[model samples]
Target: MTHIRKAVFPVAGLGTRFLPATKSVPKELLPLVDRPLIQYAVDEARAAGIEEFIFVSAPGKTALEDYFCAHAALERQLADKGKTDLIERLAPTRMPEAALTIIRQDMPRGLGHAVSLARRLVGDEPFAVLLPDDVIRAPKAALAQMVQAHARTGGHMVATMQVPRAQVSAYGILDCDEDAARGRLLRARGLVEKPRPECAPSTQAVIGRYILMPDIFDRLERQGPGAGGEIQLTDAINADVETVGVTGYAFDGERFDCGSIQGFVEATLAFALDRPELAAGLRARIDRLAGNDRFAA
Candidate 1:
């Protein structure tokens, strides 16, 4: 099996849900805690041995590109102040020269179109696709787990989670059978894009992480508008089921859907509570707020 080297990040969405805040700022640049949402995804891809990073972005999202570049003035200021620790913390944000590539999507077609834009950069090798909106908290990065599984299975793989049955329509549902030999690995028969609750094949919902073969680009190139009148990535993957075979790896992690306001706040509080410096004060504040009569149920 060929080792995965490149990863594509589709960051072209308008982020309408965020309204005023996303008006000028790309959603991926929004801070999850101390770091931006895209930072976590980049760190996760690096951990999984990805060497080349491709960002499929739209117009007005140049901030995403700037975020990964070194700020020389700021660095010099920090060095002048002898803040070595601060400099070390900033090192991870800079992408190595030529390792990062930005491609313009030019339109808001859909996930399939965005990923297809990276075909030339990805070439014929199997590559990973990571959606920054899904911030997964895990002992092992989610993409790394999928990479390990991909090494053994050597086909298309996707990170999956069992969402509530009622919520199946919000995600691409998988028709799969649990692999008896390997726990948590599901052998996919097909995929349904946001099927109604009663029509869903299973509760196994496809998440944002994927390790897919390059042949998928061909499918996406020919695919028509699906579901919400856009070129759905699920449709292209579904087209490969009979020929390529797809596997679902239920990753061991707590995924925070940062695409929504509620999930963003939940992730912020959760990450803040994890930091020793902020936890105590945050906990006290939470206690006070909960006890206040103004917040009474």
Candidate 2:
């Protein structure tokens, strides 16, 4: 089995949803509690054993690149203050310094186009693609689980979760049969890009994590615009499954769709309430909301 060594992160999109907040700052840099969104994605990739990081960024993302850069001054200042623990916590976020490579996506072509920009950097090897906007928090990171599934099955692996029948229209739905061995696992026969609720093949929707084979580059290269005039990753993945087999791993994780306003708020509350340090405060706040007398009927 080919071990996936590289991962592509598409950070080129203009975060229009977040508006003024994301105007000066990239959406990937949005803070989730204490850590930046991109940090969570990078940490997840590292846990999945990815050695090389290829980020597809745009003009205003120098700050994003700088965030991962070594902070010699900060380290020295921490050392002077005897803040050894703080320095240690940040040290892992710095990858050998050279492991990270950035590519500029000249335009907001699409997710597939952003990934295609990393082909030269990825160099014909299997690579993982993670959408930082969809942060999944669990005991075992979602990407790590996908990699393990990739090792088991030589083909591509897509992380999936159960979506309500009415909500299937919002995601890239999958067509599959129940795995004989694993109840959650599915043998993905095909993928449909945001099918209508009535037209969706199955309720199993593909999430943001994917372990793709190099053949996807070719598909993306020739793939036409679907939802918009931009090349979609769903088209490429679906193309591969049409010719070859693809597998879906029911990820054992809780996903926070930070792409939208409601989802981001929910993610914030979930993450904050789960922390032992802040659970009490969060509970108190929730209790106040529940018992507020202002809205009583």
Candidate 3:
């Protein structure tokens, strides 16, 4: 089987949910604790052995491109100040010269359309697609787990997580059966894009992570508008179920939908609480706030 070396990040969304904050800054550049949202997704891709990074972005997202570039002036300032620790912290933000590619998605058609724009960069190899909105915290990165599962099963794979039955309409629902050999892997029979709760096939909803064969571009090209009158990636993947086959890997992780204000704040608190330096103080503040009558419902 071909190795999955390339990964695509679709960052073209307008991020209207974030209002004034996203008006000037791309949503992917929003800070989660210290690192930007896109950084976490990139880190996860690196953990999965993804060598090439392709970002499908829109016109106003130049900041996203600059974030991964080397800041020589800042580096020199840090060196002059003898801030070696801070310099070391900046290392991961620098991307290798030839490993990064940014493509323009001229229209805000949909996720499928954004991904389709990366075809030339991805070429004929299998690739991974990660949406920065879904920040997943796990001992083992979700994409890494999917990469391992893909190596065993090939075809196409998606990250699956169980959500409340009532919330299935918010995500791409999977119609699948358990893989007998691999308990955590599910053989997807079909995919439903944002189906109503009454019509949902299962509670296992597809998250942002995906491992797809290059042939998916063809299906996407022929695909018309689906749910929400946009080209839904779920619909394209569904079209391949009978032939190429899709697998669902139930990843062990805590996922935060950072696209919304509530999820973003929740993720910020969760990540801050994970840091040893901030944990004790944050815990005390949280405890104090909990007991304050001003915060009473």
TM-score of each: 0.97, 0.94, 0.97
Error of 1 at 245 (Å): 0.6
| Tens-digit per-residue lDDT, 1-297, candidate 2 | 328889999898888999999989889888888788899999999988888899999986898888888899999999999999999988766877589999998988889999989888887778999999999989998888888777768677789998998999889988886545275568877888888999887888898998888888888888888778988988888878856568888999899889898888898888888899999988988788779888554
* Best-to-worst ranking by lDDT: 3, 1, 2
Task: Estimate the lDDT of model 2.
Answer: 0.86
Candidate 3 residue lDDT tens string, 10-73: 9998899998999999999999999999999999999999899999999878999899999999
lDDT of 1 at 219: 92
- Please, what is the whole-model Cα lDDT of each candidate in the order they appear? 0.91, 0.86, 0.92
Question: Could you tell me which 10 consecutive residues in candidate 1 have the lowest summed lDDT?
Answer: 176-185
Q: Distance from true position, residue 227, model 1, in Å?
A: 1.8
Query: Which of the two, 1 or 2, has more lDDT?
Result: 1
Q: Model 1 over residues 204-260: C-alpha lDDT tens digits? A: 999999999999999998899987788989899989998988988999999999999
TM-score for candidate 1, please give it.
Answer: 0.97
Worst 10 residues of 3 by lDDT: 176-185
Off by over 4 Å in 1: 179-181
